[model samples]
Target chain A: MFGLRYLEDVVTLELDASKCTGCGNCIEVCPHAVFEIFEKKARIVDRDACMECGACAMNCAPGALSVDSGVGCASAVITGAVRGTEPTCGCSEDADCC
Target chain B: MNESTRNTGECCQGSSTQKPVEQAREQQECTCQPEEAPHWSDGSIDTPSGRILRVKTTLTPRDHLGTWMVHWGIRRMRYKITPGLYAVGSPTQQSPVFVTANYKMSFDRLRSQLWGRHAWILVLDTKGVNVWCSAGKGTFGSEELMRRIQAVRLEEIVSHRTLILPQLSATGVSAHIVRKGNGWRVVFGPVRSEDLPRYLDAGMKATPQMRCVRFTLANRLVLIPLECVEWFKYLVLASVVFLLLSGFGTGGYSLERIQDVGLRSVLMLLIAYLAGAAFSPALLPWIPGRAFSVKGAWIGLAAVVVLIAYGLPGPGVFDNWLEAGGWLLLVPAISSFLAMNFTGASTYTSLSGVRREMRVAVPSQITATAAGIVVWVVGRFM
Candidate 1:
């Protein structure tokens, strides 16, 4: 959350304005302040700030938001790579990754 | 100075009169209790499914204590409430049903904000984790929600066909599945519990500011204590090794040599820890790099500068500048590595970005630390 922004173009966040109902659900759920409503449609105002938590996408009732979201922890990714499984955030009962 | 004293100092602080482990055990026992007797107010009501425990919407001293204990990494895993239905006020069969994690803090925050409102809180079993984390782990997913709904017989308790879930829990829950399975519509609430009032008043619609996640200075600062506590063991091990190794440079171990080396090494390790783990997260935005490793390295460099300005461990102990130079490289490297670990807890980092940063940063850190160790060893023998 520190203001140190990473690669500007790497986030997977996408919004379909045509399908958006201008409900502002995406704006209400995004912790990064990534969306803004203009002309009754949700627009990605700060795309680079997105951490890809997927809250905005899930709250989009009209199916207007989408993103590839997963745990950002490095250790968990490495563990998943070694074990040959999809990376988890290490909160599951089977994995003690954290 | 010794193990017992060090442990006492580390484990006990102001207001933390009880031992952490004991508190943790107590918390576990509290959660593990049978659900037959609910921990609610005297005005609890018995419904067709089960008893709905009426609870105060305001936070008590015990709640504050629990929150503080969690912040300090005490009883964190056991800080949960029993999963079931709870009542905030005198709600009838038609009141709104809100879903949340059983983590006491999440439950407390939600209930406390609903001071005068009558609502039904559907607590999902999250194994003591908050809503966001539990959602990411799938513990707060569709299956759990469905199970809890059936267990609580929510349909029989309320007349509504809608369930309000926190927006962050979207990752683990598929609204389509829930709707199709139970015929109950899911309404995603705001990112924060405080915004629930406005959301409810506006016909369950959210505003722009309610969705945004802000990691302000205070939020960043709260995370430092837990990080410091978690890394304290590694810090101790590193300090001991550095202290013992510092004596090798002077040919033999002497009281004065041991004391000097121990003090300086411990000071350097402390500086490295504070720079990387504590200060890095606290001053994250101001640090002049996009990469966390680079940000940590800058802070480590600042620590090195401070040490150098204070006179780099007098030449009387070491043979030459080689040992000093080694420390100059090693301390910052340690700081950088610890700072990189913060990427997991941070809000801005993405999985792809963390992967990319690790590819470049990890190797450089390994090389720098290894090279520093080699230089120190060679200087010792010389």
Candidate 2:
């Protein structure tokens, strides 16, 4: 991230600490280093830095993590709003995304 | 470099003990046709699994050119390799299997980084998307990985059962499921293929730097081409609309007025576009705002200053103060909206953050643009 920060408190990423077995899978998969193991439990240390990529949730075996993840591009949002669909980069069927 | 490596090349050349008919049969067994060999692969290698294509560790001139073209958004979506298994150098049954997307750029980067090393390259069909993106869309998920593994008969080919996938691919792939499906342990490698050599040398362990993704100045700048290209069609339409609008004036629909004011408006818009798409991104970190729209509007404000200075009375660029005021609002609005669009290319933006920004930014942009156009029209009539 090298001094590049997005909007704070806007990411939907959340962790249910009671369910965390602290297998360190979230630390392994997160690109932003958003989670860290604290006393055998996963802690959201840098919550603001989370991009909500959902890698943690997917890899979390105990179902401790969850987030509303999707492509964060503006054009995708605009296109989805116009077309009445979920925000997509339009890379798959439409073939017009970056 | 060694005798075994030389033997691999010779065997692939069909100069060894294997018969021509047998070679043909092996080639036919692969998912890809012999004649349709991807530009990157040199020839096919006969393996216990099947006939897998052999790729060189170095990238060719054509590969470099193709990557450059894709950066400019030319044939980007179709720039893909035939998805299946491939061999780099003379990989043996014990060599590690590296998983990647079918996108040529992704394959090329992973292979080229292997320079002088041997590994099995298992390409997943992500419809030409890079690993991170396809993973986000679920093309690189557990189901696809399990399917590709079975299709290639990977268990029979490799002595080990570990699959080395790019760390970013974890977004879609659940390691536990892949383990549960067939006991093929999934090992997530470094975020970048550039770090492969170190990761491999360190016994498949990744340092913190290898896991974290960074968006330095170079990363931000390289995405500018696609961003600019995406706006091309819109630019043309906006220019035509402004041209038609410029024909209206106190003199009553003069073509001469259109040539003067229309050309100026187009130039202003062009500057605004570059300011938002290129300049703002280059200076993104230094820009004093968390929201992309605010950062873009600041740059747009700077553009307004430059345009006004250039449109001094002797230059005769603007007819009156009202026209200049309209431009001041219009230029920043366009720049702000365009800059907000860059969230897709950025590495660390969240969906919630983008949605929150759009809720406020989009409405403000529309209002500013509409007000600017109305005021400009009123000024023209006066």
For DockQ, the strongest prediction is: 2
Question: How do the residues A17-63 of candidate 1 rate in per-residue lDDT, one tens digit apiece?
Answer: 88999987667667778888899989999998888777777667788
DockQ of 1: 0.29
Task: Report the error of model 1 at residue B187, Å.
Answer: 1.8
Could you give me the TM-score of model 1 versus the true structure? 0.84
Clashes of each: 4, 0
Off by over 4 Å in 2: A94-98, B1-36, B309-317
Cα lDDT of model 2 by residue, B233-252, tens digit: 88888889988998998867
Q: List the residue pairs that clash in candidate 2.
A: none
Lowest-scoring 10 consecutive residues by lDDT in candidate 2 chain B? B1-10
Worst 10-residue stretch by lDDT in candidate 1 chain B? B1-10
Cα lDDT over the full model 1: 0.75
Model 1 per-residue lDDT tens digits across residues B1-382 = 0001001221112134655334323322343545565343436877887666788888878789889998887867667777778888888888999999988899998998888988899888676678887887777888778877876778898888899998888767777678877888887788889999899999988876776666678988988887788689989998888778767755575556558756777877898899988999899899888888889999998877665666645542344567666767787798888788777777667777777778888888889899988886677656
In model 1, which regions exceed 4 Å deviation?
A: A1-4, A14-28, A36-43, A56-66, A78-85, A92-98, B1-31, B34-43, B312-320
The pairs that clash in candidate 1 are: A1-B347, A28-B211, A29-B211, A31-B213
